[model samples]
Target chain A: MNSSFRVTALLLCMGPLVSVLAEPVPDLTATLKAAFTDKRQATLDRLDQDETQKLCTQLRDQVPTSELSQKITRMNLATVKPPADGKYLGDWKAGEVVASTGTGLQSSDDPAKPNGGNCYACHELAPTEMAYGTLGPSLKHYGKLRGQDPAVLAYAWSMVYNSNSYAPCSNMPRFGHRGILTEQQMKDVMAYLFDAASPVNQ
Target chain B: MSVQDRYISLVAACTLLGASLSLPAEQTSEEAIAEYHAMFGDENPAELWQLRGEELWKTPRGSRQVSLEACDLGKGPGVIAGAYAELPRWFEDTGKVQDLESRLVTCMTNLQGLPESEVLAVKFGDGEQKSELEAITAYVAAASRGSRITIPLDHAAEKAAYALGESVFFYRAGPHDFACATCHSESGKRIRLQTLPQLTTSEGAQAAYTRWPAYRVSQGELRTMEWRLQDCLRQQRLPQLTYGSDVAIGLTMYLARNANGGEMAAPSIKR
Candidate 1:
């Protein structure tokens, strides 16, 4: 048999094995899109990535590129809209309820009802409340420490409004950016952190 | 001499009290959590579901009016021992890697002649929809209590499932851009007081996987693995995961395989 013919037979024998090995791996984006479905309040559109989301995913929560981080922060900051009335504080008593209630954005939850900030799920607000989470820093004396300074008030409002504006990949949710909370809800939570008589200060 | 003796006795008593006072007032979280588990050992609320399952296993009440006596769980027909430990295996008949719930649903329709839609309709147990599947799953898992986890990954499909699961675990996309790995891949990370298991590690995977199909104190129900996975996805703010889907089984395969050699400890009680 000719050398060229022998080589041709060898290639034919390896074709199936090579093809099997070369089969493209399933794309993560495509797999997730296929696996999840729109049910109740959770729509299929959620699977679609925004620019900020894409960057955060690519970096895996680490701020890898300074230029990208600045761009992300700038883009997210532009999305934050301050209260029209220039009010950053609301009834702290009402705020406590908003902070404590941990039900919102879930498919099982009723869509008609307003969303909750669920701050207590990640922060210690009241010094007396024995049961509190440690995912975020303790705000036990936030009001006493900051003392209603205008700049401090604005900073807190901005943080709660859209945390990503400051920290590109912060674990804190963009309550206002994602429409997770209303302006009144954000102001109320602000009062909970800034009211002198609030249990968080006491 | 009497005064000196009394004074010395008083000093000794004070020292003893001081030493005792220096000891911790309460148990550490780890110790307390361990004690919580130990308190419910072999007599957890999960046992009640297991009993109900055993009764259902023998009783015949389906569309075909037959029990699941002829069903095969990787093991031979009607065999319950050590069957769950080797689950999420590739079933030749189904030509798919099925987890416990998926395999159970298959048996319900194929062997008992029940409609797949009917079985899937009431997957979770609620006020008026008490899940028979949950009870059956608890019973099957309890049977393999001490058996070592040995999820098979020999087949090409099984390998594919594991790969898909691994990708799903780390695949970050959503409003929050959080993946399963975001909360689970790190050690000593937590949401609140509740501890998050680092599933990428063998120890974490083993600890977390062995405790599933557990009786949740908060829910007051015996939740199957499928229920647990669905809730996790919900908290992630992602769209609802279709129950008994390939992705769900794939994630299970990845976690179960990572937990190889760990003893099965399902039907456990969890806070």
Candidate 2:
């Protein structure tokens, strides 16, 4: 047999082997897009992950390296926008409402209604509320423990704006940064944490 | 009494008081929740759905006027014993990896000649409206009671499905930046009063996966695994997960595979 004929036979033998060896990786992006549909308040675009989220997802249960963690924190911290009017506190009563209420941006939620902080879902905000979660530490006496200094107030504001700023990959939602809570609502939540008369302080 | 005798009696009384104080210390919240669930005992409402499902399975219906007795659940036709424990497998006829719900859709459409739309119309049950799929899932899952979970991942498709599921579990997106891992990757964590299972570990996966297709007391409905995934996504503030979608099957495959060697105990009662 000629050299060309032998080469053709070799190529034919290797083709099926290569195909068998190369397992097809499912197109997850396409699969995810196809798997869900747009609903009220929640659209298909919500599935799109930002850089920080993508990195966190890649890490999964594993802790990120300190450098990577700091990078994420810095990226998220940049998104935190302090109150424009320089007022860090709002009505404590309204803040209490925001902290307790859990409905907001959910598919079933009405878009017209204001969003809630849902702080009690992962925190012990007040001593009276019996059904607080243990995922986060008890912030029972937040303001009482940390005095009302400008630096402390700024830290609290930034923390709520983007929890990843302090603890990267925190379970807490980025209320201000993600548009889950408005500037007024976040101010109210801050009051709930800092106001001397608020239940959180008591 | 003598001074020595009085001193000894005082010490004994103090010891008794300490023991009594320690004996009835308050129960942890987890213990309390478990006790509350146990109070229901054999009064699981899922039994009603299971009965309805069994009837649906045996009775002849649809355009073909055939019962689901001839339907194959990865254990040949008409065999339901321990079938669910080995599900989310590769199906030759459909050429896809399917969970219990998706596989039923196929059988209902192909064997019974029911329209796919009609079969999938009601994925979940509401107060007045009932879902036939949820009922059927209860019946099928019950059949596998005490059977060990054994997702072999032997087929290439099954492996692919498992991989997709792993990615889905870890993929964080949406407004809250939450994935299944956010709440479920840690041990002894709670979201409000509810105790979350750490599904990353085998113990957590087995404990959680085996008790699905439960009668949710809060909703007054029997919920299937598919319903669980759908609701979870909704709570995550993400788009609505389509019924019987690939992501749903993939997630189920991942959870079920992690629960390998665990005994099935489905159609259980839940809060």
Candidate 3:
């Protein structure tokens, strides 16, 4: 008797709302949610979006609002942090190793291991580092061209710290923002660029 | 065990077949370049990268909190547009013909006061600094948008880079005993749905070289030029390549020159 009473109550509640929701597309959130099986470091929360991410998705990389873009840049710029010691540019030799290796990250990666830079995968840094990608510019002899300009130094640092801070929808990852690189690592990469004795200059 | 053996046999067969085949007698390097140029009618995805890259160019970064507005790019400090077209050109101050990624490293270290090694330590798609390299490259390439793909071969460095690139391209190693020629030597070879362009031919070189920093729909991440090379290296299973290594640059010089005049359309989106 109770079961039948409950059924009737449920039917009554749904009957009116059915018509109201008839024009709307059926929600598939439940189906998608049910299919999700998060494993090891990979969680479902990656699907969640903040305001800027949502806007980018809506615009599909064609965000028309210059005001919105500038707003995003300014907003992200405020989030960046400077090194504690105020030192930049570390050892370039270590950086070359870092740039070459593509280890760490992913669920299989050991959290204890340091991450790699994988520079050859995109930008051409050292002319000798063949098998480099052409997606970005060739970085061979980068130091020779720039020659320790103060302004150049700041821009490169900011780009690594938080790429989005520079460009709202930049493809580059936000290293400092995401905590991917330590302050020391950023400095080492800097040395790879500016050091006169580095292979980049050679 | 037999399955593994079969894979070995298949590889062996492929090697034999590749060796046996050559470019069609009538197909000239010029024809190959023309074939690549034909694809330019479609939109150049590099345009998008340029926009994002330009924004990143002068944006402030790091703990010091500054922008790259004054960052020098080859001709002078803070100039970005068309800088890419001439680069891998000679630089007198440091006395080298550095590529873009290396140049960004210099600016980041000196201007922003970041350790060069840490940034160098990062790999493509691995960390934030590497990502900046991508954005900057896109921005820089965009400055040379619609410009010709002329990797100046006049410099001794350029010539040396070309020789190194050629040597690297054919250098064979790894568990599978593969070389770049394995997949890239022919006009019609493919791994699956993707057609492998013959790197030996100018058309293939241009089509492949001029379309990087590509956005991959399947992976949903922007692939940098370095990442592309690294992926090839990874699949090859040799020792991991170092960033800014001479071998990589030589290969780049070789390929870029082969694709010269094809035009750049980077920061391209790919399916």
Candidate 4:
């Protein structure tokens, strides 16, 4: 058992009923499967845990061994496809719209509508937006600070494409790998971060 | 105007803006927000739901045309005051550890002679359909206002539920590799402007658990604990949690037990 599990076991053993601690926690995966059903865009397939997901579950987002972390990062990086036409920038105005919208994949949402980047949900993209979330760092002066270098552009593209590539088990969703955002939408968002005229730079 | 005059005016404007921006001594942004919240606490629209709930509890309805006054909430039949503070307890009659909503459904079915399927089908209130469940939950939760939360763990089942809940809270899955702990395990974190409560610790859990079953001003609906769990999972990209499922009950037991000494403030208002 891991140190955390051992600690929990010890705590449970200290309780009045020793027998209860020995009664092994029942299998929950089966129970979870039985409890959930398909509805709208959310299907039973969403419950299927892959290798990376299973490992993350075991680690609880705690930084795992260097080897395992590297493996997860490598695995996710492979899924990120560079823009098809080698164009890494799109309309900043369109990007702004995508970043602000928060609806898409939810079952209650309209499936026919295109997905939103929802960037403001976790990041400060513009200095004027006072109500931005702080879970992710403020990118208010992103382009102004980073400059319009090719390497910097590529780095930003990959970060949004598959955040786990850089920080394994990151809270940021894999917008590209998960198909949450289209290539065109991602390009527009890149422009919003890189374009000199964009409010993000201002 | 002369350049010197413009510069002096600019400096004065800058100084004024800086003073206005500066926070008062020893007060955190959270504290400032708390004071702001306190200012509007009395105007909470949740009172309307409670009034409706009180009326429903006494009125006769359902197939049997009987009021829910006879329902035994594990505190004996019709004993409601202070009962919510010690809930998700082992119910001897049902032989299952049930949360308030589950128990209410049981009572509604058994005591009031309503069909379980029918009650379960009418999940949430949308428009004028008006969920009876929401009204009843508001009434029951309000009854325990000021009473300390003291969820019992005497039963073996209750203990197991707590353990399972702790496990589930940390359990990660779905497309984004999100768990409840991913956002909430740490203190002083926010996803956007919404501050995520650290549920692993007593201070955080107590603060969060007490204020749920809140009237969401945005939704214009009163949301229950069960709805909170389901919605959290939905955002996690997991399939919807079955209403009043064992998973939801287990999670409730874990949170409620942690909030042992916290005063009940449910049917609270939320943005």
Candidate 5:
């Protein structure tokens, strides 16, 4: 065969192989939409990614760039709404229940009932709780060590309101920001952390 | 004093003091759990499900009154040994990448003429709801116990599925803002007392993936990978994941491919 003809024939044969090898990436948005269906409280809209989620998802297994992280933190921090009455603390006894309770937003959870902080699932609060998880830093003596300074209380409130405000892509849930906990419930939890009489402080 | 005598005295002293005898200070919770598994020692209750699965596979039912003996599970028809390891592969017949459960649904619908609804009606058994699919999965996985996971991403569809699966693993949404990576991407982390496996790495993926289709003692049922994923999404507070969906297959492909060289050990027992 002529040299030109040989090259042309080779190219034609490799065409199918190349096409087969370079598979088109599936549309993840469409896939997720079709894969998940509304169940009770969790709607199809839950699959919709916000700006922070989209950025975080793209940066899978990689920490966000410092600039991007700060931007995300600022954006999330902007969403935080402090208590209307300016009271940061409530009943610590009630807060203990909020921290221990691990039910809310889940499809199996009852919508009528109140949501829980489920803090022990990731942090060690009261020293007596032996089964506490270690995902987050120990919160034992949180109030004892860090006194009730206005700035300190504000930081703690923001952390509960939206964890991403400080650490973008945090595993901790955005309890107040996401409506996972009510303002009153959040105040109660704040008390649980800061009250000197609270078991967490003890 | 002998170890037994010392232990007895310790227990007695604790009982007299109205204090509970706790695990040895040196024995971590994970080690204590490992010791609990050791007590079962070849006494897994999964065997009961396996036996039931074999019977279901061999029995002739469905509209066609044919058995799944002719079903092609990546390997040729009726060749089940080590076939599971190469699953979520390209199937020209369906023109999609399918995991074992999805493949079984295909075979049941095509070969046995069983309705897809009936096959997927009772996905996981609870109380009175028994799953023949779980039984069959146990049987098939048991057959490939020692085989290495070797999901061939050779086909274009398979490659696409793997890519999609990886994305799904890291995709975060919902009220909780959690993804599979949230709980599973970190090592030595726990949600309460349950250990979270870091699935982004090979060792973590293998450790987590190869042990599914386990007999969950807590649930009193044999759970499959599909069930595990569904339950996880539920906990993440995401919408209910559709059975045999592309995303489901894709996630399976990602985990199975990541667990490429690990030995299969499904139909195992778990807390």
Candidate 6:
């Protein structure tokens, strides 16, 4: 198991049960198949599930043994790669654009064009941006609150790269791990989070 | 803005002043709701997002000078359908955990070769840039509609994230002292005509969580579930949440787990 998984296994072993079983379970997979018909710029192949996904599906959110959770977490953690230049911070202004862009990864995109982060979909970052969402946590003081500890920076990096690495079923996109953000973009986003000048700290 | 209210007020004022103040009455709330639906129709704009997402999946652009057909959606590169259902899972090739959006970005940058910074520069939910993400998300969600949400939360990091997410959900802030739970933890609350679902309850949370990437009639755009949650915070008079923050995902995980078995109704229409 990767280090992350080992740590998760240890942590979950000590934590309370986290699962919340869904009731009145519909024939979810079948419903998915039936509801989604292959169309232009959309397709049916996305309906399939992987092995780990199946297990997670079966368990819903009640995580099984802590060790197993760690195994999974660590395995994913191994995937993160720091920037080529070894810098984790970027221009938060540019990062704001990355955070805002919610494009790419679909049939609608030129495919030749780049993708956006759609960060506002879940995060509350800057104070001035009136239109925002709350599905995620408010990051208004991300930098000011978290401080620039190496652990904090790394953790943030990992969270942006692959939130699932830290939370198996996390809803946030793995900006770096998933390749949604470039090293520079990741740095820019990092700046948006850590830089005192960024609005997130205002 | 009710037609009947306008008519009544006009009639009363005219009667008081003894002047004819005849005008087209405004629509009733029910009529207005119906008008909204009629204006909205069954066809969600999100469908357009799904359509465009598919195009982006194949067409060649970006610095890589290659089409995304070779990129994997967890099924394998170029695999479109059903890939999203199993996401937030670990991938060894990249050696990192990824969600649908992040993975798609990987494909776009690696295979397409768009400057990651340029692509990341776009805004969320508006402008030309946000539209791309919406279309792609709609398409991806459409790809996995009906599939179970199975995010592996076993990683130590994943576990930590859950801890973080759980903590974040209970966190309250803003001038009015708001938390996600403030409106969602309890059942059956609303601002005006809008019924707020109780997210603390499994049944209500699932209902709220499952029906996202929804077409918003009010905004005239297709928004993902993420947008739904973030917008709620904004309405609560809180700070603007940046795109893709950890606490957001943690909170989302909390909600997702609660809504696990709800059939995916993504790309659904909303008011």
Q: Order of candidates by TM-score, top first?
A: 5, 2, 4, 1, 6, 3
List model 1 lDDT by residue over B1-271, tens digit each.
4544543443344334334432332333344346545644444666667877887787786778888877799998989898888878999999999998999998998888888888888788864577889989999999999999996578999888887777677665555566787677556665545667777767888889998898765455789889888888888778898788888998898888888778998987665
**Chain A vs native chain A, TM-score per candidate:** 0.83, 0.85, 0.75, 0.85, 0.86, 0.74
**Candidate No. with top TM-score:** 5
Clashing residue pairs, backbone N/CA/C < 3 A, model 5: none
- B2-117: candidate 5 lDDT, tens digit per residue: 54454345334323322211321233446544654564445566776787799999999899999989999988999889987777798889888889999999999999999988
- A1-202 per-residue lDDT for model 3 (tens digits): 4545654654453212111111211222222223233434434343334454444433332333567778778876876777677666789998787766655444344658887665555566776654454434567787788887777777777877776677775534456766667778877877887778788778
- Candidate 6 error regions (>4 Å): A1-202, B1-41, B93-96, B125-130
Please write out the lDDT profile of model 4 over residues B30-68, one tens digit for every residue.
Answer: 543354366544555566667778888898878899998
Worst 10-residue lDDT window for candidate 3 chain A reads A16-25
Candidate 4: fraction of native contacts reproduced: 0.53
The best-first sequence of candidates by DockQ reads 5, 2, 4, 1, 6, 3
Clashes of each: 0, 0, 94, 1, 0, 88
TM-score, cand. 2: 0.87
How far residue B128's Cα lies from its native spot in candidate 2, in Å, is 2.0
**lDDT score, residue B254, model 5?**
85
Docking quality (DockQ) for each candidate: 0.23, 0.32, 0.01, 0.30, 0.34, 0.02
TM-scores for all candidates: the values are 0.80, 0.87, 0.46, 0.84, 0.88, 0.49
Scored by lDDT, model 3 comes in at: 0.58
iRMSD value for model 2: 8.1
Give a tens-digit lDDT track for model 1, residues A35-92: 7898788877777777877677655424335677689889989998989899999989
For candidate 2, the per-residue lDDT at B153 reads: 84
Cα shift from native, residue B106, model 4 (Å): 0.5
